[model samples]
Target: MAFADELKKLIGKGKQAAAQNSDKIEQAVDKAADFADKKTGGKYAQQIDKVQDAAKKAIPDK
Candidate 1:
């Protein structure tokens, strides 16, 4: 398969997996965001939260 086609297939599989386990994905996003906030000493909590929200929203609903 061509590189682009392979990438597209991989992305599709990823989306399917995300939809199957959206709750877990959101939890991981939250944990990562919290870790980032803590590492930054909460200096960017607002920005981190915005990103966290966006990430959670991006997960496709089943």
Candidate 2:
């Protein structure tokens, strides 16, 4: 198979897994965001939160 097609299949599998465990993904993202906020002394709390929200949204809701 072509590299692009292989990559697409991999991505689709990942999306399926993410949808199956969205709650876990969200928890991990929240934990990572909290860690980043603390590491930056909360200076980037708003930006971190925005990124966290985006990451959570990236997971399929299916």
Candidate number of the best TM-score:
2
Instruction: Compute each candidate's TM-score over C-alphas.
Output: 0.79, 0.83
Which model scores highest in lDDT?
Answer: 1
Worst 10 residues of 2 by lDDT: 53-62
Error of 2 at 37 (Å): 0.7
- Regions of candidate 2 where Cα sits further than 4 Å from its true position: 1-4
lDDT of 1 at 15: 93
Which runs of model 1 end up more than 4 angstroms from their true locations? 1-9
* Per-residue lDDT of model 2, residues 1-62, tens digit only: 69999999999999899999998888999999999999999999999999998998888987
lDDT of 1 by residue, 1-62 (tens): 69999999999999999999999999999999999999999999999999999999999999
Candidate 1: lDDT of 26? 90
Clashes of 2: 0
